[model samples]
Target: MVKGIIAYIVTDGNGQDAVKFYEDALDAQVLSLQTFGDMPENPEHPTPPEAKDRVLHAHLRVGENELMLSDTFPGSSLKLGDQVGIAVMISTPEKTKDVFGKLSIDGLVTMELQQTFWSPLYGQVQDKFGVTWQVSTLTQDE
Candidate 1:
């Protein structure tokens, strides 16, 4: 099973702008970039052409962890608040299941575990103390 901390999501009103700022200010590298409309293989994913310029995914290396950036989908009510849940991305189905099960105990399941086009396993839950988590198992060929 694959094991590693992939990255942390940083939501921003201007994702590309924020990434650019961080790249310049912190001397960070833009390891990879993926635009919403430019997503390969899945044509029915609903990423509008207008969002082609918006960052769907981006990676900037800072120390040991990669800081991921993504623009909020147009019309999405979700916004970055004072409290943000750190996503724990696993890379295998086994790990995802294990983590999900452990977290589910005494925790509230915000989103039940399910397979997504983007990942093999994905789920969200709030632990007993109310800390939110986003867990995923890599299905991306990369």
Candidate 2:
């Protein structure tokens, strides 16, 4: 089952600043914020010093919808205009895989569906129309 769709905003390196701006400007209430430094230390892939302070994920509530934000890792290929994407929250890993596979048919699969620290199933794809989508199963907290 599809839970909800969220607008995810990605910043180059100043996600904290953007969060503050939205808090004041749009009166968004931040539910959670995690920086790259907050991630569990993975010896194989260390968090770059420049990205340690960058937001890995932020969840905010505005009106009745959800607003998410994050920062690209240092030296990532994410461009300014492509920073905005849609996140499709699914109810189960099975449903998430179905949706992700369908979305990746003619689109580019940026990240294959796989388990991550935050979700049981998570992936990213850019549709044929060029809109990026992050598909994932909702976590317990979500």
Candidate 3:
């Protein structure tokens, strides 16, 4: 049985930047940061020299949520799109607006925050790291 599900992001070489962005945008705290070089060398799982400085693992506390991420393995890449989205249910419209505004700064806003049939305030945006977010105010009936 699973205890919980933590959103994990894999970037080509932007995991560090993503962690910093989340820390600032969501006011999240970085619990742990590890680089590939921090790991012990293994014959079957060797760490590439060029990838040594990349993020091997990162753990963050986004508000009360847990988020983990890592830079892709050597010779790998990342592509973002509508495949997945991280949804945030805040306690107030103010937070929804604030988070949306911060995350949408250098990205795209597909929906403006406003009163919706299902929520008091709801919006969708793609942050600078190419991560899509759905910010909304938690409702009673949800």
Candidate 4:
């Protein structure tokens, strides 16, 4: 089952600044914030020292709605129009796979569904309409 969807804002490297701006402008309450530096070490891929302070993910409550923010991986950039995306929160791995498969039809798969430190099942896809979706199964911690 699908749980919910949230608007995800991607910043090139100004996530912290953006968070502050939103907090003041929208009176958003930050539910949680995690930075690249908080990720577990992996021999295959390491977080760049410069990117350590960048937000990996941040969840904020604006009024009664939710807003999420994150900084792009080091070396990546987002053109102004491409800074936003939709995140789908699923309740189960099966539902996640089903939704991911449907979203990938005639669409570009940016990241194949796979396990990561944050999610047991997660992937990114740009649908036919050019809307990006990040599908993830919710963990207890979330």
Candidate 4 lDDT, 16-64, residue by residue in tens: 9999999999999998899999999887988889999999999999998
Q: Give the 10-residue window scoring lowest on summed lDDT in candidate 1.
A: 77-86
lDDT for each residue of candidate 1 in 1-142, tens digit (9 for 90 to 100):
5355544554544778888888998889999877776676465776666677778778788767667767766766554451356567777788888988888899899789998666778888878777767788876674
Task: Please list the residue runs of candidate 1 whose C-alpha ends up more than 4 Å from where it truly belongs after superposition.
Answer: 40-45, 80-83, 105-112, 128-130, 139-142
Residue 52 in model 2: lDDT:
89
Kindly give the number of clashing pairs for every candidate: 0, 0, 0, 0
TM, every model: 0.72, 0.96, 0.53, 0.95
lDDT for predicted candidate 4 compared with the true structure: 0.94
lDDT per residue (tens digit) for residues 104-135 in model 3 = 99999978888865579878788889887767
| Residue 127 error, candidate 3, Å | 26
Residue pairs of candidate 3 with colliding backbone atoms: none
Error of 3 at 45 (Å): 4.6
> What's the CA RMSD for each of the models?
3.3, 1.0, 13.2, 1.1
Q: Which stretches of candidate 4 lie over 4 Å from their true place?
A: none
Across 1-142, the per-residue lDDT of candidate 2 in tens digits comes to: 9998999999989999999999889888999999999999999998888888999999999988789999998998787578899999999998998999889888999999999999989999999888899999999877
Q: Candidate order by lDDT, highest to lowest?
A: 4, 2, 3, 1
| Model 1 per-residue lDDT at 61 | 88
